[model samples]
Target: MSQKSFHVAVVGATGAVGQQMLNTLSEKNFPIGKLSLLASKRSAGQVITFNGESHTIQEATPEAFEGVDLALFSAGGSVSKQLAHEAVKRGAIVVDNTSAFRMDPNVPLVVPEVNEQDLLKHNGIIANPNCSTIQMVVALQPLHEKYSLKKVIVSTYQAVSGAGAKAVEELKEQSKAVLNDEPFEASIMPCASDKKHYQIAFNAVPQIDKFEENGYTFEELKMMNETKKIMHLQNLEIAATCVRLPVETGHSESLYAEFENGNPSVHEIREVLKSAPGVTLQDQPEEQIYPMPALAAGLPDVFVGRIRKDLDRDNAYHMWVVSDNLLKGAAYNSVQIAESLIKLNLL
Candidate 1:
């Protein structure tokens, strides 16, 4: 609530990540002279409370951006593709939380801790990196700075919430059905609109998004490509395998990285990550302490642990990373970009 507040709008305000965005804005006390909540036609007129005030949701349309200074979008790739440009055209800065324009070559894929400076190059819109990518890059930025990165291999245990609110409900309902030995139906998982859906309770699905000709799912490719882009290492060799777990909120990853320079000691890497911004070092093998999705739920910082050098390669190391997919991955990161814009005088 500053004197120089701006008009702000949260598109898709009724969805999970969208609700989180509104909560984040209120928690951070983001300067807002006016607040607009927008959603699809079906959700229009729904009521949402923020700062103890109720605001009716409006239908998201091109004209909704009029007089808005900042727009946070989490509707979907298709919705973003349709309205983000319209928002930008109305002089509103858009921080898109979808893959709509992530690799557009013009839009900056940003994780503030990793490549905030890239925000200066953004043209009206900034793309938030994948949830898994965001946490990984946050934990890796300091390491990559001290020891140049050569390659990365990541396997992610992602949460069902990343798919959306309905997916989380599906997980709960399916879990109960299985426990009770009752029949249950699954029609929204792995990829909701894909050719088929699979059970996400008491099971792990290897596919996250649609598969490409190269045999990699789109989610895996997003992590691989987004890491290189955010780290500004265009030629960085990276591979990712993304899987959906039964967890409700946090996403976890097992990361193996090779450095260009000789391998740094495990202690050295620990010391660096302990001091890295937005990263919490939780490695303590002897005491059985490490990052877990349950422990990381509702937290903002990326948790890193299980540090050890690769068995055969002297220049390679592996670690575990965990974070709340909805916060740092989607909502918090978008708000952070708006803060960066103000701090960097770009707004």
Candidate 2:
């Protein structure tokens, strides 16, 4: 680690992902000489304390970019699209946590363990993939490298927290209301502003984000599309079905993959996953052990378990993966990118 620190600015510091970014930065002891928190005018002047010091949030504008060496942005797409360039023009490198620039060819959609080298090629901004996509790629990247992943099909049971702080509170309130026989309203679970809102308490909603022209929800499409981009596999076959579940935190996935060469034994797969970067293998079928959302909450690394060979598919395997969607999926990954930038001298 470099003894010299950098000036860091965190945009959208009032939002969920942005708050996690700050926590991750402090916990990881990121090299910070100065810290700036930027948010909308609505949140400007609000104070956030860290390391026993208080820093006030400022309105995010072009002028706020002055003297900023690195900027982490998690505001909505509109805000990111509006101010990310301004931050860059003011000589700050941005790691954006919105979908605004993920698909832009010039901007690298990065997950450090998957593609740390991508940061070196960034044109001032790096896009962080969706939460679902980040954890999936981290687990899959190692397998993709070893087994030559021919295809990936994943179904995610995501937690309410992925929808932000509001949706989390909504779930808690709806649950209490349901338990007390009180009629609760649903206005935020599956696409907050969509025509219809459903109760997420004690229920599963199969839609996340809005449906796209291809009948896939935007969240699902992000996993499918962003995986290919970050992995640098233009021809990788991927499908995703992202769902919002009633869980408070963490995201779990059922994954099926077809390998190119041979059917690796269950033991081999476990060992490979154990050695993979940013992954923890928890498969122990005899003792009824596997990855689960409850155990994964607040953890930084992706958890993989239930490794087995597909019955009919000679080269296919099945597994379950879990992680704290807010940590490795969003905040920790962004912080890791900044670390990579420092290690590789990209910043």
Candidate 3:
């Protein structure tokens, strides 16, 4: 960390992930000379406090990037696509949290624990992977380095927070409606822009983004494809199933993995994870200790637990992973990328 500070801008200042960006900036004590919060017209003029100082939210425009050394964007794909280049043109490096730019060949999608080296390769805009993907890669990267991972099959129990602030409110209202035996309305889960919405109050939704032609939701495909991209492992095999749960925060994942030429015992895995950066090991089965989303809310670190061997395969293992979705998975990851850029001397 440097004594001198940098000017920073946050796009989508009123959103779920946008709020996380502010929390992360303060919690990390990021040497911020100035912080500018940008949102749509609807959220403009709202006030958010940072470092005990009041900062009024401003409307997002191309001009927001002037004098900003870095920009953390979480508004949406369309917003990022429109303004990211403009920010870069103003000499501000962009850490974008939208699906719009993740797969771009010109952009680098990064998680610091997973591929900090990729920061050195950015051309101005850096992409942040999906929240579920971010936590999984943070846990898997160390193990992959030790054992040379061959495959990954993961299922995620994501929270309503990943959907947005509105979705969280919808879940709460619908739950109360159901409990009172009122006609519960369904208009938020599954997909908001779709023809219909499903109830997420007491139900689980198997979809995160809309389905693609291959039958995998766009969110699931992001994990599978983005994993290989970030790891730079063209031959790696990955599969994902993403589901939205009623929880307000935290995302938990069950991962099954196989390693090539890996014969390490469970203890060895624990030792490796304990030494990995931004990761914590909580694998005590007999004591009933494990990672759970309910316990991971509002935390920055990735939590790992339930480490064990799969009975069906000798080189296979199973694990549970947890983290705050909006934090680590989105806003925090974007901030970490900016931090890495500073450390790597790229900015």
lDDT of 3: 0.90
Best by lDDT: 1
Select the stronger candidate by lDDT from 1 and 3: 1
On residues 53-107, what C-alpha lDDT tens digit does candidate 2 reach at each position? Answer: 9999999999999999999999889999999999999999999989999999999
Tens digit per residue, CA lDDT, model 3, 1-347: 63768999999988889888998898999989999999998999999988899999999998878888999999999999899999999999999999988999889989998888987778989999999989998999999998999999999999998889999899899989999999977887878877779989888889998999999999899999899999888799999999999899999999999999767889999999999998988888899999888888888889999999888888999999999998898888888898898898877
Residue-wise C-alpha lDDT for candidate 1, range 1-347, written one tens digit per residue: 53578899999999999989998999999988999999999999999999999999999999989999999999999999999999999999999999999999999999888889999998999999888899999988899899999999999999999999999999999999999999999989989979999999999999998999999999999998888889999999999999999999999999999999867899999999999989999999999999999999888889999999999999999999999999998899999989898889887
TM-score of each: 0.98, 0.98, 0.97
Worst 10-residue stretch by lDDT in candidate 2? 261-270
Task: Mark the regions of model 2 whose C-alpha exceeds 4 Å error after superposition.
Answer: none
Model 1 CA lDDT for position 160: 95
Model 2 Cα shift for residue 114 (angstroms):
0.9
- Report lDDT (CA) for all predictions: 0.93, 0.91, 0.90
Residue 47 local lDDT, model 1: 96
lDDT score for candidate 2 against the true structure = 0.91
Clashing pairs in 2: none
